[model samples]
Target chain A: MGRIKTTNNQISRREIIIEKAATLFKEKGFKAASMREIADVVGVEAASLYNHIKSKNELLNIICFDVANRYTHKMEEVEASKLTTLAKVESLLRFHIDGMVNHFEEVYVSDREWKHLDNPYLSNMQNQRRTYRKRFAAIIEEGIKKKEVKKIDAATAVLIMLHAIGGIESWHRSTRKIIGKELEENMVTFLIDGLRKI
Target chain B: MGRIKTTNNQISRREIIIEKAATLFKEKGFKAASMREIADVVGVEAASLYNHIKSKNELLNIICFDVANRYTHKMEEVEASKLTTLAKVESLLRFHIDGMVNHFEEVYVSDREWKHLDNPYLSNMQNQRRTYRKRFAAIIEEGIKKKEVKKIDAATAVLIMLHAIGGIESWHRSTRKIIGKELEENMVTFLIDGLRKI
Candidate 1:
């Protein structure tokens, strides 16, 4: 029972570290944030932080890949769904909006700090990103072929949708008077409606 | 004659420094890049750089404000024009696209690095940004009133357009097989066409 408790404690501690690290990375950027600062924020000694996590780079890798994997997994589910192209895009946009809203710090760090990722991991993230974009564009292309979506450049359309959703980050910094649901619906109306054939 | 030649040399040298600083800031981010490195890129001694520019933060301020001023000035022109709301938006989109392509480094630095500006400058830039968004949204509101645009949340639509244009930075990282004109036209279609009242 003690051993099991220890393992559970370790898992939660690691999560706490990642949460703190995400905030730091988002505020100070990955290159400028230090492990000591992360440890301080997590309420642990810098030395003990090494016991829970390997290094600052490891923290970045975990944050970046975790978010990337979430996106990839969401896209996979989106691909398998029986929804129409427009519905699929809306679903994807909702997922992105939720991620940005609920997980703003993590999502922002993943989006901006992914560039600081080192080798193997960097390439892996890039491949995952490229594949995700291709899959997204494919959905638009399918929509175009079926006359569900307007005749638009699939890649450009995909870029606009994904990037526009990222604008939620800016909204977070704004007055934020618009509630989350309203913002999501308005964005969906703007983006998905734009994609639909006239 | 010597004084006039010296003035021209100073102006050109300052331009070169800004050009090189934009590249460094884009590559290494504002906080991580150094003025000395920028001087090295421009083949000037680090001290000589001070002669041309005040400091690294000043360079960032210059790059960021220059881009912001351009956007504000363009909007001023659009506001004064007799063009329909949709045409005004299209014109603004084209300007944004061209800036992202031609002055890619400067525009990018402006978008991402503006946060590093000090107090008054930071607040000043933020005010300009807010004003710009308000003006853009007001244009859309006018469109909705005149039945020129769909009855969507003007703020949300403006956010989509600006954020979508920022996505071109991602395209610059990709294969970039899509030429500038095609990308611009496609984006204009997806965004502006969606705005047109059905």
Candidate 2:
């Protein structure tokens, strides 16, 4: 969420606060992160911090919904494309991997801290995730129908893909052997390629 | 852990307490699952639970390390076998899937609730997990060397496998479309079968 102001590509103070808070939230959990702490990191008074955001909970909402919205938006683009079922799945997988690797802070925090999200937000987040997975499963189902992919359980395939992406969190923490593009390439090859090649 | 007694194969009261504890732990978390709750579930007085086990920590230790030990022992047995690399990987995957499917309470509680374990146990548990993943990666490496598996990053392959297995928790919670052996078989076909076939 760049939220750029003008053609010069200036990010607002709000974006800066969000970025720094994502890091802090990743280090200390949502429950532990404070407005004073966020204010300190953003070089503003705790009072000033509230001018841009309402509360710690609001930061979480922004972070969580931002990541979810980005994925949903991307899924729309991928699904609408004229790409084949295999390409569609690979494109979506790359999007998830890219988010995990580069946008590590927001993506990781969003995935883990969603449990702390409030009712309407939490319920909405769950629905978004459910819808996203269903749409993903549908792509594989289409592949199976067109005889372009293996006749396997599509929902299971989606489950494997999503959780495999989640594995990148451990990948982030571990002594990583591959970085960025290579990791993305390798996973795409390992996952969706099977749906079509076999 | 069947720990079946002689002949008739009866599980002891201690075993019943452990089983009941696992379910309570899974439901209410290790912290929330008090001695009183475990006793209530087992139909014993809270005082009686202490006779069989020292504390909640022991129960967590039993659940976490028990699962760890079972996997380690199984890993040893599978490693000792003269099976081919592909077969060995398939064997391990089936072992994990079996654990996730059949032993949901113990396995689920163990995986999620290990964080509440004390220092030595936490450190030791981390080591066991690290070693297990390394060993799993080694098998994939061996498969690659033997030209039985694709030339992919072995460590990443292990990451994917383990996290994919973690996905089974969601499978347990979701409206499951497939059951035990079918889930295991589908996963095996999706995972290790690629190593040789490709």
Candidate 2 lDDT, A17-103, residue by residue in tens: 899899988866565677889878777677887778877788999999999999999999998899988889888888999999989
In terms of docking quality, model 2 is acceptable
The parts of candidate 2 lying over 4 Å away from their true place are: A1-57, A193-198, B1-21, B24-57, B193-198
Which residue pairs clash in candidate 1? none
Per TM-score, the best of the predicted structures is 1
Q: Write the per-residue lDDT of candidate 1 for residues B2-80, one digit (tens) a residue.
A: 1112244446877878888999989888877876788677776688888877778899899999999999899999999
**Model 1, runs deviating above 4 Å:** A1-11, A195-198, B1-11, B195-198
Top DockQ model? 1
Which candidate leads the pack in lDDT? 1
lDDT of each: 0.85, 0.80
Backbone clashes in each candidate structure, one number apiece? Answer: 0, 0
TM-score, structure 2 vs. true? 0.81
For model 2, name the residue pairs that clash: none
DockQ of 2: 0.26
Q: Per-candidate TM-score, first chain only?
A: 0.90, 0.85
Model 2 error, position B178 (Å): 1.4
Model 1, A1-198: lDDT tens digits are 111122444468778788889999998888778877887777666878888888888999999988999998999899999999888988998999999999999999999888888898989998998899999999988988888888888888888888898888778988756988899988888886652224
